[model samples]
Target: MLLALLALAAWRAWVWWEAREPADHAPAADVRIEALNDRISALRGDLRAQAQRIQQADATNRVLRDELLGMGQRAALIEDSIARWSDPDRHGAQALRLDEAELLLAMGQQRLLIAGDLDGARRAYTLAGGVLSGVDDPAFLSLRQVLVQERAALDELGDDPRVRALARLQAFTSELDRPTDAVPVASAPADASWWRRAFSTVFDIQPRHRSLAVRPADRGDAMAGLQLELTLARAAAERRDVEAWRTALTRADAWLQRLWAPSPELQGRRDALAALAALPLSPELATLGSTLEQLRQLRSVRQEP
Candidate 1:
């Protein structure tokens, strides 16, 4: 306002001076020149203020843009995490990760107990329990619950406790969640020799003493893996997803066939596989003979055990 008023006053003074009849033309020219300079000066000052305002606005806009970009990135990450949690393929992977985490917790607590770190062991076991909360895969659930118990036991036992408290494995759990699809390893239960009867009771399996007649040397081997594959093959049978069924069947058969096929050099595993394969398929066994044959042919063309 002051600059505008100054400009107006200067213009009026110049005009009045011009309107006054001066004898010399030089006086009139000098008055006109001074008025032109004042107008230029005012224009320059307005342009400088406008430039500063523009720069400030640009800086503000840049900050806003950076903030918006950060928000977008955060949203994208959340979407990816949601997708992973809900994906069918990821169900198995998530379960696997949780299983690993539980095992780690157990091992950590066991160490703490050994080191005489009772409180640390207690916290570790608690965290381990939390990791498997709400998880319902039967085999894994059983094992996870076992781990929870193990954690508590570790807390109960003080440093270098009697008989290494875990020696009996009453609280031991296996990594397997469900009975495997393929074949069961005859002997290896999740608990070492320490916790046999207790584990069977907890998992609702027949007593080890009784199963001994049927169990093989590698009972707990990849029995779960094999059984799972067989189940997958059976599931595909409904849709007659022949190729997929064949893939699964072939995988199961090949695993068994590899055990005790013709080559005596690798006799033991081949023998086990043959025995397992010879057993009659359960009532839920699929009737996809052609699919099974296709798998056999594929395996045959590849290599024998």
Candidate 2:
């Protein structure tokens, strides 16, 4: 404001001075006005150039600011990655344990759900427990508890009466290889009169027909019969039929007795059969339902960050 006012005042003073002077000063005043106009024009051009330079500088500064911001963001990302990599909890023995536990859990699930093998499932569950024992995270602790429960449930399922009976019947099929017991035969009186024996031989009519005498059980037939009985027992156990299972087992034992002589091994097999027959027709699976699926879901959840 002050500069513009001063310039206006100077211009007015010059005009007044020029008007008051003689005509002799007219040419000089005109020349001076021309010089002043040229100076103002040059000053205006300089001002325009400065303005353009200022604008360019501002644009460059904006670009530099954006680049710096991007670099800062990249640096932050690198630092975060480094921190994560260097974290002790995410590597080494704990990491390996977590991986092994997950693998064992998966194996246990496959054995239980797909193969229906309780022993295999238990083995896998036990191994998982061992792997997870060193991990102290709350997630891992919960996982361990789940493993224990599932393993126990599997054991209970294995001990189920129906399952036990089926196993026993299957095992009984192996007993067919034993030799058949010798069949007892009654002999004719040796003290009988010689005339009686001679008369019987001459008439071809004897007190006992040789061909009609009892014979030892046929090995093939006994084995086949035993197999059939076992099949029946297994089916009955599957069907949860108590009386049918008992009858099948009894028939199987009778076949075994015919094919195997009385001995401790035979007696033990019979005792096992009798024990299975005494079990209930229906047995509870006991906390086994969905145990594997729950464990799998837990494992998946814990694996996430």
Model 1 misplacement above 4 A:
1-23, 88-97, 100-305
> Model 2: which residue pairs collide?
none
Q: Write the per-residue lDDT of candidate 2 for residues 115-193, one digit (tens) a residue.
A: 4566777888788778778887676566667667767767766454557667666666665555554432223246867
Q: TM-scores of the models, in the given order?
A: 0.29, 0.38
List where candidate 2 sits over 4 angstroms from the true fold.
1-22, 103-127, 136-139, 151-305
In order, what lDDT does every prediction score?
0.51, 0.70
Candidate 1 lDDT tens digits, 16-117: 888765656778899999999999999999999999999999999999999999999999988878876776434675456564554656555444533444
- For model 2 the TM-score comes to 0.38
